[model samples]
Target: MNAKPLKIGVIGCAGIAERRMLPALVADPDVEVTAIASRDGAKARQFTQRFGGDPVAGYDRLLERSDVDAVYVPLPPLLHAEWIERALRAGKHVLSEKPLAANGKDAAELVALAEDRNLTLLESFMFLTHSQHAYVCEQVVQGVIGELRTLTAEFAFPAKSADDMRYNPDTGGGALTDIGVYPIRTALMYLGSDIEVIGSWLHVDAARQVDVGGAALLGAPDGVTAHLTFGMEHAYRSQYALWGSSGRISVRWAYTPPPTHSAVIRIERQSHVEEVTLPPEDQFANVVRAFIARVRCGVPSGLEGESLLIQADLVDRVRARALIRPAR
Candidate 1:
C-alpha cells in the first residue's frame, strides 16, 4: 500500500519560502502544504493566495492543528531551536532553516528531542540536494582531481539596508550565520567532520552589533585545508574550488542557483581543462521529496542527529576564534 501524502505547515513566510520552497512543495504530488503562518496575518494570507494553503494567524495555532504532519520552519536563526522543540513535542516532523540554532548546545538538545520522539528533524540546506555538489564530491573521490589539498568556498552579497534581518544582531544576524555557514558546511562535506579551526577573522558592525563579514581557515585530519569567506556587505561571489596535487576543480553558481539555471563545473589538470555542464534542477523540490520520504517511509537521507551536531560544533569553533575587526 502507498503511504499517505505528507501534510506540511509552513511556520514562516520568509522570502525563501515564497520564492523557492513553497513553489517546490506545491509541485510535489506526495506533499501538501496544509497551512502557512507568519507574524503578519496579511502576509500569510498573501502567501496562501499566491501559493496554496490556509493562512494561519500564529505559528503556535498552526502547530496545534491535527491536519499538519510536518512543519517547514524558515524563521530567523535565533527562533529555530525554540520552534523546533515545540513542533517536535506537538508530534510534527520538522525541517528548519540552517544555522540550526544560536549555538551548538541548543542544536544538540533539539537533535536529542527528535531522536527521543522518533521524529525527523532536518536542517534545510537546499544546496546539499543539488546533483552538482554530489558530482563534484564523486570526482574528488575518484581521484579525478588527484589527492585533495585545499578547498576554498566563498558566499557574499551586499546587504546595506538597515531593514535587512541579516544586519540585526538580536535576530542572530551575522554574515557567518547567514551566508558563511554555507562554505563551512560545504567544506565539512568534503573535508570530513574531524576538522579544526586554525585561524579566523571577522569584521564587526559595532553600531549594528553584528559580524558583517569573516574568513576562516580549517585544517582536516588528513592535512587537507579548507578556506571559507563570506560577507553580507561585499561584491557578489558564490563559488568554491577544490585544489588537488594533480589538478583543480571549480564550480560556479555553487549556492542559491535558481531552478532554471544550469551549473558548470570546471576541471583543470596540467595543461588540459574540462568543463562539465549539468542540467537545471530544483533542489528545493528534492529537499521536499527527501523530507516526505523520511517521514512516511523511514528512509534515511544522511542528515541525521550526528550531522547536525558536527555542523553546530564546527560553527561554534569558527565563531570562537574569529577576531572582530571594524566593518568596512
Candidate 2:
C-alpha cells in the first residue's frame, strides 16, 4: 500500500453513483476520484466537473489511464459482469454494485477471472458494512431474541418512469433484482447459506416488462425459516423481523439508509419483555471505508465464492420456476 491516496474511476454516472458514491468519494481523504465515465460523455463531464475531477469519454478510456488504480461499476445489472471482467483484465481493482451479476453463473465467472488477475472484486452490499446490521447480528448471537426460529423481510418502492432501465427486462429489471435482493440477502446472511428455499411466488408487470411484486419462503435445515417479499408498485416500505423461541427482533425500515431510525428488538421471556434500541450510522461512509481498507490492506470484500454462488443460484432457481404472466 502507498502512503499516497488511491485513485478511483467511476463508471456509470447514474442515480446511485451520482447520489451516493461520488459524494462519498469526494469526502474521503484516503481516496481520490480521479476520473469519471459514462455512455453519455456530457453527463460524465458534468459529474466529474461537479466533483472536481476529469471526465473520460467511456469506461475503456478510463481503464486505459495508468493513474486510475481502481474502478467503481454502478452500471445496470446486465452490464455488471462484462464491465467487471473488463476492469479486472485491465488490471484495475473493482468495487461493483450488487447482485454481482444478472445471475450466479456470471458471478462465478467474474470471481474466477478476478482471482486469476489478483484483483479485488466485491459486490457493494453496503448494508453489511453498517453498524446497525452488526448490532442486529450481535443481538441474535446474544440470545436477546432466543433461539432464532423465523425471519421475515419486506422491501417495496414506487415504480420508476415507464421507460426507465429498471423497467426494461433486457437490462435485468424486476422487483426482485431491484428491492427484493436486500431481503433475500438478509435472509441468507442471518440464517446462513445452507438454507433451502421452500416455496416462492412472483408477479410480473407486463406494462413495465418486469416484476412488480413477489415473495418467497425459505427454510434452513437447522430449524430456521424466512419469508421475504419485494415490490416496485406499492407504497415505500422496508422492514425485517426475526423471531426466536423466546422473542422477536424487528427493524422498521431495514434495507435503506436511515441514519437516525431507531429500531426495537423485543425479547420476551416467560414473564418479562425487553426492548433493545439500535442507533444508526452513515452506511455509505462505512462502505467507502471498508472498500478503501481492502484497497490498502489487500483484504477481500467478504464476498467470496461460496455464499455469492449460493445466492445467485437461489435467485436463478426462483426466477425460473416463478409463474410469470404478461402485464394485465
| Candidate number with greatest lDDT | 1
Q: Pick the candidate with the highest TM-score.
A: 1
> Once model 1 is optimally superposed onto the true structure by TM-score, how far is the C-alpha of residue 12 displaced, in angstroms?
1.5
Worst 10 residues of 2 by lDDT: 258-267
Shift of residue 164 alpha carbon in model 2, Å: 2.2
Report the C-alpha lDDT of model 2 over 1-328, residue by residue, as the tens digit: 4478879999888788978777888888988899999878898888977986788888899989998999989988888888988899999989888878988889899888977887777788777776666778888999987899999999888777777777778876677876778898888889987778788778887665678788888898998999988887778888788888887777765677655656555556677767777665667777777778876777655555566787888888667767775544
TM-scores for candidates 1 onward, in order = 0.97, 0.93
**Positional deviation of 252 in candidate 1, in angstroms?**
0.8
Tens-digit per-residue lDDT, 1-328, candidate 1 = 7667789999999888888888999899888889999888999999999888899999999999999999999998888888999999999999998877988899999999998999999888888889999999999999998999999999999776778788788786688887888999889899998999999999999898899999999999899999999998888999999999999999899998989989999999998999999999988988888888788777877565788788889988999998889986
Candidate 2 matches the true fold with a TM-score of 0.93
Cα error of candidate 1 at position 60, Å: 1.0
RMSD of 1: 1.1
Deviation in angstroms for 74 in model 2? 1.0
